[model samples]
Target: MRLRGRKGIRESLEKQEDLVVLQPSLWKGRWSEYFGNSNPIHVELGMGKGKFISELSILHPDINYIGIDMYDELLRKASGKVRFRREEDGIGLDNIALALMNIQGIEDVFAPGELERIYLNFSDPWPKNKHARRRLTHPGFVNKYLSLLNARGEIHFKTDSRNLFEFSLNSFADLKLRMRAISLDLHSDGLREDLVPTEYELKFVSQGMPIYRCEVVVGQQSLEAHEIRLKQEGRV
Candidate 1:
C-alpha cells in the first residue's frame, strides 16, 4: 500500500508541520502534551484521504484526533482537507494531528491506555485465509488494540468486506471482548447520527454494498489479561 514519487507530497507534508507529525515516536506516551489539552485522544488507522477523521475533529472538539497512514501522498491529500475555516483559538485545527506510520507499528507510537478510541474504516480485507492475521481486526491485532485502549476505550470498525467483518466479530468473541452496534446494512439502520462515512464508505454505499459496522470494547477479563501481558513486556 505504498504510493511514492508523488509531486509535492513530501513538500506539502513538510509545510503542514502543525498538522502532520513526521516523527510520532517523540510523543508516544505524552500525546496530551502534544495537543496541549487533556482531551481524550482518538486515532483512525488507515485513514485514506482523511475526510472522516478530519470532520470528526470538527464535530467533537473535546476529543483529539489523529489520522495515521503509510503514505505521505495520501497524508498530503488529507492535510489539505483537514484544515478548518477558523481553527479553534487560532491553534490551527486545535484537536487534530496526522501521523505517517504503518498500522502494524501502532504500538510503537501509542502507549497503553493512551488512546481513548480507535477507528478502522474500510481496512484491507486481507481475504486470504493465511493472511487473516494481517487484518486489523484479527486476533493478534485485537490483542494489540486491547493493550493500547484505555479501560473504557473501544474500537469503531466499518468495512464493506463481508469476510473481514465476520472474521472480526468471531475474533472479538474468541478474545472475550464486548461487542455492540453490530450493523450489516448501515444506511438503513436509522443510526445516521452515528454514521460517519469515509471516502471508501460512500463509494461502497453508492454501489449498494452493505456496509458492516461494529464496536469492540475491552471487557474486564480482556483488560486484566492485557495488563498481564503489559507487565510481562514491562510496559505497565
Candidate 2:
C-alpha cells in the first residue's frame, strides 16, 4: 500500500545516508566496492517496508543486500526498521543498503551478471490485461533480470494473487525458463524456519491467506537470447 506523503520524508531518508544509497546509479557495476566486499549481492525489487530484506541481512552477514523502493515514505519507513534492528540487536548494517528508485530503471544501477539473486515479494499484480506489462514478473522485466543475474542466480517470487502467480509461471514457460520449488500454499506445510516474511506477507498469513511462491532459474538459451538482444541493440 502507498503511504500518504509525509512531511520531511526526504529529510528522513537523507539522514540515513549511511544506510540509504543516494545517486545509486553512479555505483553501478561497483556494488562490491560500495559494500567493501565481494560477497554475492541479493536485491529485493519493491521491498515494501523492508521487513524481509532487513531481517535477511541480519540473518546472513556473508551476503550483501539492496532493497529498492520507489516511494520516499516507504524507504524512510524501511530505513527506520534497519535502524531499530541495529540498535536493538547490536548488529552491524554493513551488508544492507536501501535505494529509492523505480524498478524499470534497475538496469542503470546494476551491470550484467552483478546479481546473485532477485526477490519479488508481494509485487503489484496489475490485474488488468492492459497493465500486465507493468507486472514485475512480465517477460520484459524477466529478460532484464536474466541479463543481470550470474549463471547460478535465481529469482524467488511470492504473492497472494493467484492470477498473477499463474501468469508469471506461464510467462516463464514461454521463455523456456526452468522453475523449481513452487508452492501453491507456502504455509500449508507450516512456515519454514529459513523463510523470511515481509510485512504484507505477515498480515496475509495472519488472515489465513494462501501464498504462492516459485524460484525461476536462468536457462542457457534465455541468457544467450538476452545477450544477443543486447548486442543487437548495441548495449553490450
Candidate 3:
C-alpha cells in the first residue's frame, strides 16, 4: 500500500526541512538539544504514513518524538499530517521530527543510550526464512537496538501478522530478554484510552483481525549474554 513515484515527492520532502531531518546522523547524541529540551525521546521506527506518531505527538507534548521511514512519499504524507494537526490543534511543531532513511543505519543517527523507547507498529513481516535476518525484531536488529537504548529503555511492538508475532516472541526469548504487556488481542476488550492505533491496526481491527503486542525491556545481563551468544555463533 505504499505510495510510489508520486511526482515532486522529493521536492515536497525537502521543503519540509522544519519537520523533516535530512541529515539525521549530524544530530547524533544531540537530539535533546535539537528538540530544545531534555524531554525523553521516543521513536516510531518504520513509521508508515505517520498517523500513529503524529497522534502521539499531539497527545503527549512532554515527549520528543521522531518518526523514521525510508520512503520519501511516506515521509511527505506524514509531514502533511503533522503540519495539519499542528494547525488544527494550535500546537508548535517543536516536539516532532521526521526522517527519511533506512532503519539499518539507525545507529548512525542516534548515539549509544540515546533513545528511551521505540515503537514498531505493523512492521514488515519478512516471512521467508532467508529474509528473517531483515526482520526488525530479529536478534541482529535487537542487538543494534540494545546499543542505542538507555539501560531501562523499551521496545514496543504491535502487528496483525501472526507469523511475525510468533517469530518476534521467540527471537526475544532467544536473547533471554525480558518482555511484558503482551496482548494477543489488543482491542478485544475495547481500545485502551491511552492507545493510539496505527492506520494498519485500525484497518485490521475493523476486519476482526487480532493484534499482537509486546514490550521488551533492556536488561544489562541479558544484553551481555546475547552478545556472548552472537560471538559464539560468529554473528557479531
Deviation in angstroms for 229 in model 2? 32
- Looking at model 1, residue 183 earns an lDDT score of 90
lDDT by residue for model 2 (40-124), tens: 9999999988899999999999999999999898888899898899789898889999998889989999999999899999999
Q: Taking the tens digit of each residue's C-alpha lDDT, what string does model 1 give over 83-180?
A: 75334335457899999988788899999999889999999898998888799999888888889888658798998988988899998899987676
Question: How well is each residue in 181-215 modelled by candidate 3, as lDDT tens digits?
Answer: 79999999876677898989888988989999998
Which scores better on TM-score, 1 or 2?
Answer: 2
- What is the TM-score of candidate 2? 0.91
- Better structure of 1 and 2 per lDDT: 2
Off by over 4 Å in 3: 219-236
CA shift at 74, candidate 3, in angstroms?
A: 0.2
Off by over 4 Å in 1: 84-91, 189-191, 219-236
- Which candidate has the highest lDDT of all? 2
